[model samples]
Target: MGKPYRECPHCGAHLDAGERCDCGEPEQQEQTAAEERPRMRLIAVCREVDKDTGRIAVICL
Candidate 1:
């Protein structure tokens, strides 16, 4: 299951893939001003590596 989505906490509008809410709400002023957001990192995984050579199925997201 995925996390339940909710309306925008700032202006009660809605949030997409954007940082700011739909409206020009500044409710997150304290949060943004007080702390800094970190960039998301993608990690890959190797399913199986070749025994003879050096090959693997690197899965990425």
Candidate 2:
């Protein structure tokens, strides 16, 4: 039988006995949080007035 095999945690590479893994390499860790900014757009605004001369608006998208 071949040497025991195990799956690498970082790159998912199959590792065998006496093999080295680059899971701790800097390049691989850099892209983990690559500024995945979200995109949003303003939808609409609603306004209402009361007898006390107050204004309230509810925004909805």
Candidate 3:
């Protein structure tokens, strides 16, 4: 017989009972937010430039 296991909701990793996944932890969340901040700021800047130039700015992500 095998022991039962469960899936981690944040990362879909298999975990034993009473175990927790770090994927949803604050540290990882903060890192993700930090990574996204620059991209968002770039988009905002591009929008402002486009408005001033009267042309669509294409951002390749």
- The model with the greatest TM-score is 3
Report, for every candidate in turn, its global Cα lDDT versus the true structure: 0.68, 0.71, 0.71
lDDT of 2 by residue, 31-50 (tens): 65554545567877765656
How does each model score on TM-score?
0.30, 0.30, 0.35
Backbone N/Cα/C clashes per model: 0, 0, 0
TM-score, model 1 to reference: 0.30
Error of 1 at 27 (Å): 25
Error of 1 at 28 (Å): 18
- Across residues 1-60, which tens digit of lDDT does each residue of candidate 3 receive? 875988987688999889888777679777887888755334333433456768866664
Identify the runs in model 1 with alpha carbons over 4 angstroms from their true place: 1-37
Model 1 over residues 1-61: C-alpha lDDT tens digits? 9534557765676555544563665559767865676765979877899888888868886
Comparing 1 with 2 on TM-score, the higher-scoring candidate is 2
Question: Model 3, stretches more than 4 Å misplaced?
Answer: 1-3, 28-61
Assess candidate 2 and give its TM-score to the true structure.
Answer: 0.30
Candidate 3 achieves a global lDDT of 0.71
TM-score of candidate 3 against the unseen true structure: 0.35
Q: Where is model 2 more than 4 Å wrong at Cα?
A: 1-3, 28-61
